[model samples]
Target: MLLEKINGPDDIKKLEISQLQTLADETRSALINKLSKAGGHQGPNLGVVELTVAIHYVFDSPKDKIVFDVSHQCYPHKILTGRKKAYLDEAHFHDVTGFTNPNESEHDMFIVGHTSTTVSLALGLAKGRDLNGRSENVIALIGDGSLSGGEALEALDYAGEYDRNLIIIVNDNDQSIAENHGGLYKTLKKLRETNGNAEDNLFRAMGLDYRYLEAGHDTAKLVELFESVKNIDHPIVLHIHTTKGKGLPYAEKDRERWHAGGPFNIEDGSPLYPYQGEENVIFSCLKELLDTNKNAIVLNAATPMGLGFVQGVREEYVKRGQFIDVGIAEENAVAMTSGIAKNGGTAVFGTFAPFFQRTYDQMSHDVCLNDSPATFLIMSPGVFGSDSNTHLALCDIQMFAHIPNLIYLAPSSNEEFVQMFRYATTQKQHPVAIRVVNTLRTTGVDDNTDYSVLKSKIEQSGSKIALIAVSGLLTMALEVAEKVKEQTGNDITVINPRFVSGVDEELLVSLKKDHRFVITIEDGELMGGYGQNIAAFYGDSDMRVRCYGISKAFHTEFKAEELLDQHGISVEKLTKEIIAALRSE
Candidate 1:
């Protein structure tokens, strides 16, 4: 096979033009094979096969330094950069992560999973190269979808005036996670239709030299385009139009659904592994909120499907102006939500917890300072979220709870979340943040607890020992309580602190009278988290305190079980620790 001969970029440079085409086909097949077995960014890798091949064939990596925006399209790059074994062999499928990782290979410059950060990062690399008095091709491969990001736009504006050898390749797949948004996308469509000869070219207007290729999938054309700009003295933008899911008919037909997913069958494109969870309460609450509340609206950055508002499902509401997607700009969406709530319209914005980290300033200034009464749903936070270090959002409490006038609630059950959502939208008091953990277990009873009270719930009141649990960790606390009852022949108090923003002073004071030792457990980092408040509250008092949580670090590919156990939040560990503490007293 042509792929066997291609161990690295050196092998690709030795190939003839026709052999290069065969190599592209083989690389695509290998991508499909591994993705079918292990699953990954499907549409992105499939589309970038030719582009990656051409780039490796044209430029020298490691020395040349090509960076991929978001790095979802790095699969083909990995295959060309001496890592094709991971794709061809099923056992080695998980040898590398889906995104760019410097630990995995020398070709990958940065470990990136977030979107639209390529230009700025690449600009930094270019500046470093100049500082060292070295001249090597510095390229940033970004997509049209990423152009809407504030970082990419700022970098593009700066690149226009940057008098250096920097190449910016805009891979115009014409689709983001969903269909493209904003006027720039319309300009891209026009450029594609006009064969890059449109009036008022976007690149040229930005003060950068511009060139567009209609056939981005054409390897020979792409290689020639790359060769034309290599080692050039000035910055340039190469606009290339390509298909999102190039070879797969199903993926091409529904680019959004097939963008990224679990392993699927090659025969009929059905999922090999079923979804691991049942119906989520978050989306159901969102759907009902939009259905009943006419004055209410929902907004997302670029992840509508993450909120269960898939393409056709949200069409009617979108037409009614009840749903808005602001593309990949989280900061804009956050500020816009504040504006919406300020104007007497109910606005709820949702995004993954890690992505929401981008809007910390906007959330603190625009929403909390103005007291906009907007509802921000932080999805899949803590150690239970994505295992990737790039997307780990362990410091949400560190981010949200500290902000003044912001009520950051951690709902312990499905019913609590529903009631919390109701309370957040109905009131006009303060901005609210809800940390929806990886899973929501139900109590099978309706929760009408008044969240405005901001008090912890005591599941079992007892003397000598008190266990204070945060949100999702309440289950573990309860398990530890049961173990304590079974082994120690003593009842331990278990308190679920639903609110993380601040301590319920009355509740903590009440515990001091009866409880001797307090143990606080959370699913997030130990420092600056919900548990610390409890520890500090008993600092000057006779009640000895212990805080258990995941330590401060960018932990990746970790199981919640292992993380919890290591942090001393596990049932067995906590139970024994509780017994030992009581015995000492």
Candidate 2:
């Protein structure tokens, strides 16, 4: 009832501390109920409800720019900022996104989905405001897990030197998709225990003012803390202690499991959906390699769960000193993996596709330049790209495909992924990056393929037009090809170019004789992607090429299918385009 009456931050500002707690309670319920049915980030949003409410009550958002790191916690902020109906009602669930978006509202400063970017973006806003002779407060709400990231650390070091009005809120819930790793967490634990009196403070070491709050959920204390920094002329770090899954008993007991998941039962917090079976292609392959090879090691950057190496799987490798969780320090992880590989150890770094963006230079210079035989398992690349802009890995192909000596393989099936993972771990030729799109339906394991060859496989041989689809986009292309054949009775050649980085020169040279028009489909960006390289390869040749992928722009808050369709990558769209090209010829 109280939630219905509240419309905006002004309404929240009008409320007393007692009423604010009631508001936080209702907001958490709304979040949990919506996430139960619609399936969005549950634990993070639930934990940040009170903190978000307190910030809105204390700070003048839009005027006082508040940037949420990774922005998963922005759901509660969104609800308070005239967007409650979106999450409270099922019909309006699709209205707002899971992350912060400037396009969605004036309150949201950036369309961020990646971790550890808030500090830098917020600092820039603060600098710009000062330059323009404006005096609006700038706040960055960053998580503890994000602190280990190179960019965040870089920005923190910069912020410490800059004499300006900036407030950095460290939401120390002590988990990051998985349990937090790295030495910084130890510092945070000490700071929390000592109630801000801890010596050797990391924030102070970075040259910033520091304050600690043991009770993050207490709205009165949070408001007081914000008031203290409201008129401050220097950057400061407000470390707030909070629980990852604050309200729910089940979630609080196991923070990692409740981080983010599908629809679940409200009573006992059990998943409503059943398990779709183990992602054994990655897990089994990695397990076998680590088991046999004593010198081989696996690495993850704060996301061991995403790589399907959670719990028992991670512990087994970690005990052997082979599983390294570098927390959010992706740059460090990449370089360390390279060092291990160079020193005659088999090093494989597995991380989500988007996070790998932070390590591009290291993967290219530190690893690829030296030609280290490190294996990179890039999980969930392309259109299977999840949630918000911060999480979408749509530009991975553009980033990795151009790097020389980096063999990027896009596995078509589970069997293909298994074979490729095996090859990547075994081979000493160059760094191999497996572009794992999704957990494909197991087609009974086959270990016959030699991934070392690194060639394109022709799924269906035909004439005139060649459909070169990369990785996960293959299924969509195949569906389009089927429709084209039914309508026009023309058999179009479908080739799965597994290796996106290297030009399958032998395959391309052979295609010149048979195909006249070539169409390349990729799940990443069109500009500087695998498709463009193919287009460039045939620039002076007889074959005319049309590349289909995401355009060079920041696409935000879109369903996977909608994004694909918008980019002319859907089955109907691709089929029409191919037919038109055929007709034009």
Number of the top lDDT candidate: 1
Q: Quote each prediction's TM-score.
A: 0.98, 0.93
Tens digits of per-residue lDDT, candidate 1, 222-333, equal 9999999889998999999989988899988889988899899988789998887867687899889888989899999889998988988888989999999999999999
Candidate 2 lDDT over 391-453, as tens digits, reads 678888888878889998888878888888888988998999999887354558684778878
Cα-based lDDT for every prediction = 0.90, 0.86
- Please name the candidate that would achieve the greatest TM-score relative to the true structure: 1
**What residue runs in model 2 are displaced by over 4 Å at the alpha carbon?**
439-442, 445-447, 476-491, 565-585
Assess candidate 2 and give its TM-score to the true structure: 0.93
Native-vs-model 2 lDDT?
0.86
RMSD of each: 1.1, 2.4
